[model samples]
Target: MPERDTIMRELHDLGLAAWFGGSMMGAVGLNPAAEEQGTEVDKARVASSGWAKWTPVNAAAIAAHLVGAAGLAVANRRRIAGQKGVLASTLAKTALTGAALGATAYARTLGKKIELASSPEQEKAKKAEKHPISVESAQGQLRIVKWAIPALTGGIEVLNSLQGEQQRPSRQIWGSLRRLASA
Candidate 1:
């Protein structure tokens, strides 16, 4: 109801939006495109090249989301005392983010392996398949990362809502202070 509350709510909303948008783009847009492109050997090269080019953009997006989340956490710190539900949600989100980070790193490592071996001959492919370090593993890792993004993003949203609820009282306090000063 108070201005500070409104601002905190808006900050929480912004964090949720960034988390959702980044995760959806990574899952639905980037991962799918990479999969489709990686089907053919030449296409896989092109796809990897394209992804390499986009790495900075992806990193920027991720960094922005992390920064936003941290800001939201700071804003909500004081209000979390009476909001156990919100605190729980924030903790869950933090845990999910950490898991997603690990999964994402695993997926990237697998992708690099696939890229490095992109030019193997049929016999080499077969040999590699026998002790493969590419497609299947990469796909599995990507799948885990893909699902993780959404799960983590959704958790962030819940955390944001909880944050908003917790900050409501502080917002009122600030508003009351302003009103008293004005009078």
Candidate 2:
């Protein structure tokens, strides 16, 4: 752990930054803006289009973050195991990261559900989905789920900050000492 993992840290930070920013923007900016459209179909189309546009970039961000997180874990394995506070933060981060991923994927599924449900052609819709859900229902679910993404990711960011703090020389010294004492 003597050597710094600058690249990994950069990737983790930049990726999480984009993920958090994009989710917030979508929740506050894009979704509400899409709501101003004249019709439900239009709203769905607008929101879905915006999310679709961002999907690839978001995927890249998540991938980068996961890779960086793995790299960082490997780099700081000793600290994570030996430091008093680091293990708890690392476990919490891991759980939050998994939850965030699930929330993101679920949001996307709900988005697509509403988007397709908005189609006027009944036969086509039925063909696409055997039991197509109501647009209202799908949207209702989406409204709640979308907010979870930012919340979960934000929690992960806070955990990241705590991890950073734990790496400080003073914190490291105390954390290690505390770990040894507990043993």
Candidate 3:
């Protein structure tokens, strides 16, 4: 049995790496830099600008990851269906990906609110409704949501590791036998 080509695996890994690294850098570096610029409003503006610049690249990375994930899933469907724990772990990873996407969206929404609230234009401020909470409160929530993106993506990384281990020939055979024994 020869090792298969790793192009899709590399794509998946690189995309996840970017997602995790970018989120972490934003939370750690960008946010703090924005905090240092000046007043709370300026902080929001600075942070929003940085995030706006990152949005396209981040989106691309996510798209690549989704495509790679689908390719891998389709390639390994038989193993996933037959292996003992692969199905559960794959489902967990899928759920986590959904949660990460949701968190990222929520963070962007909070960021837009902050951007508007901090804007100089009265019309823009009026257009960007904070809803149910004040701008300051929204900022607090945004902090949590921003951090959560990295956290959830990091969990996906761990799950990816587990999936890799499950693919080892010995483990695959053991898992299949275990499934048969249970049945």
Question: What does the lDDT read for residue 41 in candidate 2?
Answer: 83
TM-score of 1: 0.61
Question: Which 10 residues in a row give candidate 2 its minimum summed lDDT?
Answer: 124-133
Candidate structures ordered by TM-score, highest first: 2, 3, 1
Against the hidden reference, what TM-scores do the models get?
A: 0.61, 0.92, 0.92
Model 1 Cα lDDT, one tens digit per residue, 11-64? 546655655665577667765675666356765565555555655665665565
lDDT of 3 at 138: 82
lDDT of 3 by residue, 30-67 (tens): 99999998688888889988998998998888888888
Give me the runs in candidate 3 sitting further than 4 Å from their true place. Answer: 1-5, 130-133
lDDT of each: 0.60, 0.88, 0.88
What is the TM-score (0 to 1) of candidate 3? 0.92
Tens-digit per-residue lDDT, 1-183, candidate 2: 334588888889999999999999999999999999998788988998899899999999999899889989999999999999888899999999999999999888778776666667786466437545666777888889889999999999999988888999999999999999999
Each model's Cα RMSD: 7.7, 2.1, 2.2
